[model samples]
Target: MGGGRSRAALVAKARESIAEGSKSFTVASWLFDKSTRERAHLLYAWCRRCDDIADGQEYGFRDGARDLKLDQASAKDRVEAIRILTHRALDGQPTADLAFDALGLVAAECGITREMCDDVIDGFALDADGWRPRSEGDLMRYCYHVAGAVGVMMAKVMGVPSDATETLDRACDLGLAFQLNNIARDIWDDDAAGRCYIPEEWLVEMDIPPGQLMKPAYREQLVQLAGRLVSIAQVHDMRARVGAGRLKFRQRWAVLSAANIYGAIGKKVHARGEAAWDHRVRIGFLAKMGHIASALKETMRGSYPPQLEPKWTRGQLMAAARMAGPVAGVPNTPLRDEGVRRKED
Candidate 1:
């Protein structure tokens, strides 16, 4: 990627990063071909690094994290640093960081563009700004930047054509599905971490006061909201399956398997109802294997057409990401990070 860095060394670090950052992803990645696997791992390393930097965590651990400005202040600085480093990585410049270097490598090999990387970085910028969704559209917009864009990059790593818009949308759908599930499962934890992704309108409708979501009196209402998030996730997951059919067998299998595994978390969270936040929900090993088996069976059958239409399209959300509230009645701009733009009215 840069002058002296060896691809092998970068790949090795990437392997370690994925192993430590996401066990589920590591398991799913093994299903990819060798070249795709390496590239996927490399891309994941950068994404993981940026996430950790944005959240003030190291390797996904958030314990005693306030010292890193987990809430604000330096969080904004951290986001800007991420943007600068990502820009460097996209430019083939040495960033003096393995994760950013890995991004440079993957972007070079896979045709990932500056826009794709910026789309993801936008999510971190939102978090840094202490921004929250005011509506369902806002929530999905956040999900698009954080996870959907990354999914599109992942599809490219799998050798998906740049012109495959629907496939890319499906890929983005999987990311949105995953993020929605995460929000459902981690609603309390995110609150504990001084963050919340649930839309303000939902909270107001439920009459759950800010920062009191976990209070015993409001637990049921919170569960209802969580269920809604999961319901939305399920729809995206279903549509994403259709997109998976467009991939090669192994890629499709890996994607559906991972989808099922993550989907299990949201289902379990919803099934638990009021008790969902009592402990963190996780898919067990046997359950993971079962999902994998189901995916294999699903893979054997020919791909099915989607039975549902998208409630929101990537193009629409991306357009939202590219705008601030209004600049002299001009909505679009080249620099679209959260620091440069506010949520549109």
Candidate 2:
């Protein structure tokens, strides 16, 4: 098949692969619209494929096959996919890799830098390394590279002005919050695979070994820590909502819908605590549809709330934002245990 034919097949395949037509709330909410739907599918496929390559190496492959397991082929595929869409976008041809193609087109059309994409890929690459993060900040840095960069990319794609610096900053904050939720949600699964992304320092300071968390003895402390993480994530959730007001109508609604859905998950986590391990919490289908309707309502009004205060203090926001790089000079508060355990940067 030619490129056009292949692209069509790819889109159809993606929709079939992602039942309910989305992998997450970010895409799931707006996917009813054709344009956004296709783009969301393609973006999900692209990001999912990249993540799978890095993660696939850990599941019972022979020792010798590890290198091949983590080969650069998936990354190459993403690049080629983007290249085709980028060309079509430049030529003013409607492209097939909708989400990613839109991503490329928007980035190019708006002059958004490509460094953010590179950073996302770099963070995914770190997954191939058999290392546990030593601090919550380290974990956030990883989250920023893999997820926060995507938030920046999406903002640029939406054509948000550089002068809307405050909004852009909050968008970045939302990404980290969402990723932290993922970490809290997937702790059991990640630990089972010998991949503990939770900060080792925090665990140590709690007088807990990550392995022992599996025991019932540490259940209360685990619950408390998990609750705290959820609270921290709420700060970003608020930032995201406030930031959404600064976007154009359509994009503003998109961000709000997404933030609402994901932010709801954090609430579920806090309520359920260790129960998150038993089953991942998801907003009910009705709740999701409701969120979409709410976004549309706000979009039609053309008026987003202005002058909303940030839920987090300036100091807290800075700590979350600096997760993208080495963290130094940041205050460390005491956890359940009294002693301090600072990891070397």
Candidate 3:
């Protein structure tokens, strides 16, 4: 968004740093021409900064939980640090700190809801404490707070209709699905970090030891779990496809392309199981090219696929029902994507 330099270059770099190749918005954003790209780059930079902070990455440093550990500071200290840094960044005051300050300005100018930003902080706090949910509902709440809030912020930036809350709703669902995939993928790695997001209840009900599951014996069940989550993800995809169908041609295709790329990870998880440990499941380069091409064709045709309906456990239904009014609607957003993004990016 900084002018006087090439806008395309800035956006290209921002995309590399923030969403890892422009994320789901890439297809639609390409339709915006130069001005929108520049604005979106600044917007993504703001988002990336806040995301890095909440996930506790150090500025200009790739590997460290240093920022997350700061949660150990007194609550007053944490609040003050966030507030001061946020202010400085907003004022463009030169300082060692920039995350919160810069993000505050972006939120103010972009109409990103304050509540959504706070929810991201809240999710980070939960992570810092090494908290794990006892039930599915608790995990869902965490997902909604962390990832679903991103959906709300995105809807604001993209100029979604005020009356089209369902688009926002589907976006939230898409975030949830993304998160759930992350949780499924990170079972081993999270254990290494002394954290676990899978609900304790699921383990207890299945009589699987959390530790043993980390081994090879539970590979089949892990695949089952992976299948179940992928099914759930498909449902979210359906809702998003439906929701995007209501948007402009470019926006709808953008949403569909992203969903397809992210959701396809489930297939890799299904096939390889623990081999997924070696490298993250990713859509192949050829597949990515195909996805882009298909997205363009589909956009022009206004063709979107029908989504698969997910079968939920009674508990999952009950949990979604609590936060989102009913299982009749889509379940609460999934919390698992953060881990995936952390590893893949």
The lDDT of each candidate is: 0.86, 0.58, 0.56
| Top-TM-score structure, candidate number | 1
Clashing pairs in 2: 39-98, 39-99
Q: Give per-residue CA lDDT, model 3, range 1-345, as digits (tens).
A: 122234455455565554553444554456544543444555666556655554455332437534323444453344345444554544545335332333444455565654455555556556655566766666766666566667656666566754566677777777777777766666666666567776777667667786666667766666666666666665666666666666666556666676666766766676786576556565766786677777667667764554343333223433443454312123334432222111122
- Tens-digit lDDT track for model 2 on 1-345? 112334566666556545533445545435335554554445555455445444553222335544433344564454445445445544546665434443444344455554555566656545544445676655656666767666765666565676777767777777877877777776766666556666777778778875776567877777776776676676666667667777666667777777767777777877886676788677887887787778677656644333334333323433444443322224332222212222233
Runs with alpha carbons beyond 4 Å of true place in candidate 2: 1-23, 26-41, 57-112, 293-345
List per-candidate RMSD values in Å: 5.7, 8.1, 8.1
Per-residue accuracy of model 1 over 1-345 as CA lDDT, tens digit each: 642499999999999999999988888889988998999999999999999988878888876735533547788888889999999988989999999999999999999999999889888878887787777877888898999999999999999989999999999999999999999999877887778899888999999898887889998899899999998887788889988998998998899889989999999999999989999998888888998889999999855655555566788788888774211123223322232122233
Clashing pairs in 1: none
Q: Which prediction has more favorable TM-score, 1 or 2?
A: 1
Q: What TM-score should be assigned to candidate 3? A: 0.72
Give per-residue lDDT, candidate 2, residue 266.
Answer: 75
Worst 10 residues of 2 by lDDT: 334-343
What TM-score against the true fold does each predicted structure earn?
0.92, 0.69, 0.72
How well does model 2 score by local distance difference test?
0.58
What is the Cα-based TM-score of model 1? Answer: 0.92
Candidate 3 Cα RMSD after full superposition onto the native fold (Å): 8.1
